[model samples]
Target: MPKRILMDHDGAIDDLLSQLLVLTMPDAELIGVTVTPADCYIEPALESTYKLLQLMGKEEIPLGRGDYYGINAFPSEWRARPEIINALPMLINLPKSPDPYAYPSAPELIIDRLSAAKEKVTVLMTGPCSNLVLALEKAPELKGKIDEIVWMAGAFRTTGNVQTYQHDGSAEWNVFWDPVSSQKLVSYELPLTLIPLDVTNHVPVTKQFLSTLATQIDYKLSNLTGQLWALTLDTIPSYHYTYFMWDILATSYLAMPDYFTTELVKANVSTRPPNAGQTYLDDQGYVVKIATDVNTGYFYDYLLSQFKQ
Candidate 1:
């Protein structure tokens, strides 16, 4: 039987790409897609998610929205950079289906689906930990029902993408968005795997790949992804079309572990105010494996194959 996977996305370009990758994988069944409060506000995030699902032809699968924002933390501008700003308006403008249905909250949907699955379910979180944290809080018993959680958060030993923050290198966006929730969730004894920026920074979306995809898949989803890549290129002039494939790498690991290099170390989140969301390899606390590197060649090849011939 195929593995059941749930994705908690923030509706960023990378998140949409990751969802498409997981849906296309032969060995994984994308059970659901949840929109978390990360890249933008919850409403826009949900709108983008709905558009992505419709474009991918997965409209029947439920799309749920997460918390509005991280608890107590001020919102940041990094969420609305040109890459996201350009893509979100396009997604919002996409025509919606005539029949609309209401879905349960992200946390509730997670519990309901996980409870009914015949086998263990893997929750792939590519955004903030707010939904997971809320689910755990409401249903603490879900601790055993879940098989594992693959998260794309933290910076590990690498310099963070957000350099303006004065905190340690380990404090990245996802965690920093809601450190209190992340700190609470990481303390749980459930099996977890964290794919940090250290690994994802190596897997970039190059100009060649984007151009190839644009030429191959003429659908709205591919076009949006391609446009996002162009925006990234414009924002970071020196990098060309190269942008971090952070979330996609995490999803890829679920179907193809051979494409990544991982380390099984005890990892924990620091909850202290200034240092919150900082993850470390500690020997004494609850242990979880974290991916430190990825096979860039394999990623490029697999992503290239996803486009139409």
Candidate 2:
């Protein structure tokens, strides 16, 4: 039987790319797509996710909207991006309709599906871990049912996306967005695999790949990815046409584990405000397998082949 996978993302370009990768693979069954709050608000993120699923021809897969904002937090500047603002209403207005899939809540749906499945379900998270944390809180019994959680967050032994003014780039966005939840999750005694920025930064989508894919996958997901890729390039200036395949790499690990180098070590999350989003590796008595490096050439080639197909 194909592996059953539940993916949660924040509708960033990389997340969309990652979903596409999972949809194209024959060995994995994408059970659902949950929209978490990060990089964009939950409303628009849900809309984008709906559109992407339509493009992939998987409208039957259930769609769940997660927390609009982090637990015990307010909206931030990151959620106010023009692109995000414009995408909000598109959720309700998307032309292609979704199946009549319904669930009481994201957490409830997660537990229900996992409980029903005979095989262990893999939970792939690529955004702030608010939904999973809530699921664990509400239904503690479901913890044992989970197979493994493949996460794309944090910066281990490297500079983070959110740097302190005092010359230390220690904090990353996803964990920083919800420090309380991050700290809570790290304590869970489950099989966890972290694909941090250290590995993702090495695998970037090049101009050649993007240009080729734009013409191949003629769908809304591809168009949105192309637009976001263009915007990311404009901001960086140097590598204007390429983007770090952050979330894509995490999903790739699920579909094809042979494409990366992994290390087993103890990992923990920092709870203090000053040290939030910090992932400590080799911590005493805590063993976790974290990905440190990736095979970029193989990843790029595989991605290109997927789009070509």
Candidate 3:
């Protein structure tokens, strides 16, 4: 049987690419998708998500929105991306479907899906853990319904992507968005697989890779993938930040686990200031599987193969 998957994401470019990866992969069935306002304005995020589903012909999948605001919101400039992506000709030209407010909110949808599942569900989280944390808090027993959570969060071994006030630059943006939620999530007994910056930092989106993808845009999904990442090309020359395959890499592990390496680590999140959202190694912390390294050439090859017609 194919893996039953529920995806939760903040509407970043890579997050959308990650969703496309699951939608196209042969070994996975996307049961549902939930969008949070972490890296996007929820309106365009939902609009783009609905449009992407239509573009991929996966419109039957349920959609949910998270209204919860993070403690430290993402930058306004970065948050504007969903609207831009949503307006692209490929997405905006598609006919709009009826609103996909499947449940009252994200947490409720999460509960309803897990409770109704016939087998364990793999929760793919590419953003903050707010919705899942809320659902599990309300229905703690739902823990048994989850197989494992593959999340693109944290920066256990290297520096984080967030360079903001009150932070010591040790936390990834997803965790830094809502440290308390991260704290609550790690406390759960469910298996957590973290694709932290420790590994993703090594896989920045290079111009060479994008040029190669340009040659393989034979399918609609491949074209869409290229267009999405092409938006980040201007930032490539900047030394401060470059687009990394953060969420897509996490999503890739679900289909091609052999291209990556993992380690069991005892970890915990700090909810206090200065170190808030920071994930640290602690003897008393929960044991979680962390992706520590990846075979970049093979991983890129696999990613390119998925989009081939």
Candidate 4:
């Protein structure tokens, strides 16, 4: 049987790419998608997601809009990317207009879908844990229905990507957006596979790969995927070092676990001070399956193949 998967994202460029990745997984069925407002403004994110689904003929899949707000939000400039994605010709050309907010919000949607599911669902979260945490709170029994949570969060060994005010740059943006929520989710009993910056740092976006992808615009998927990355080119200096495959790496781990190395670790997220959202090994921390490394060459090959397919 194909694996039943549900996804939650914060609507970053990579997070949008990760959603496309989920659709291409041969052995998995994406049952639903929920958008957290952490890294994006809600409306444009939902509209862009809906447009993507429509373009791929996956519009029937349910979408949940997140109403929950995080403690520390992302920068306004970064949050504005979804609006640009929404305006893309590939996405905006779609027929149906998107309803930004679905009937059930994110937390409620999680409970509704999990309750109705026949098999255990793998929850792929590429953003903050706010919606999932709330869902677990409302229906603690939902934990039993979850096969595993493959999340793109935290940084155990390397420095984090967040360089904001009052932070020591020890936390990843997802966890740093809401450390308390992240900490709460870790305390749950559900199985979690954490793909942190420690491993994602190895999968930086390269000019060579972009050039190769640019030559394959005949495939609509590849073209759309390329356009998404193209938007980042001018703004991000030196993409090779500045940006890594963050959320997409986590999404890839679900479809191709053999391409990566993992280890069990007891870890906890700090919720206070300059070190807030920092993940550290603690005696009392929860045990999580942490991805330590990835086979970069094979990963790029697989990624290209998926886009072309």
Put down candidate 2 lDDT per residue, 67-130, tens digits, no spaces: 4476323235445343452353323355744332443456666767777778889999888788
lDDT per residue, candidate 1, 74-173, as tens digits? Answer: 2444354423642565565667633223556888887787777878889999888898878879888877878889999887787665433456545777
Candidate 4, residues 1-309, lDDT tens digits: the string is 999999999998999999999889889899999999988898888888888888778999888989989988888877889989988888776786556754469998899999999989999999998999999999998899999999999899888888778889899989988899899988884699999999999987878889999888999988999999877665444632387789999999988899899999899999997999998878889988899999999999999999996
RMSD of each: 3.4, 3.9, 1.5, 1.5
Q: Model 2 segments beyond 4 Å from truth?
A: 71-104, 164-168, 212-228, 235-243
lDDT against the true structure, each candidate: 0.72, 0.71, 0.88, 0.88
Which of the two, 2 or 3, has more TM-score? 3
Off by over 4 Å in 3: 100-103, 235-237
- Candidate 3 local lDDT, 88-132, one digit each (tens): 878877887566454459998899999999999999999999999
Q: What is the Å distance of residue 52 in model 3 from its true position? A: 1.0
User: How many clashes (backbone N, Cα, C below 3 Å) per candidate?
Assistant: 0, 2, 0, 0
2 or 4, greater by lDDT: 4
Clash count, predicted structure 1: 0
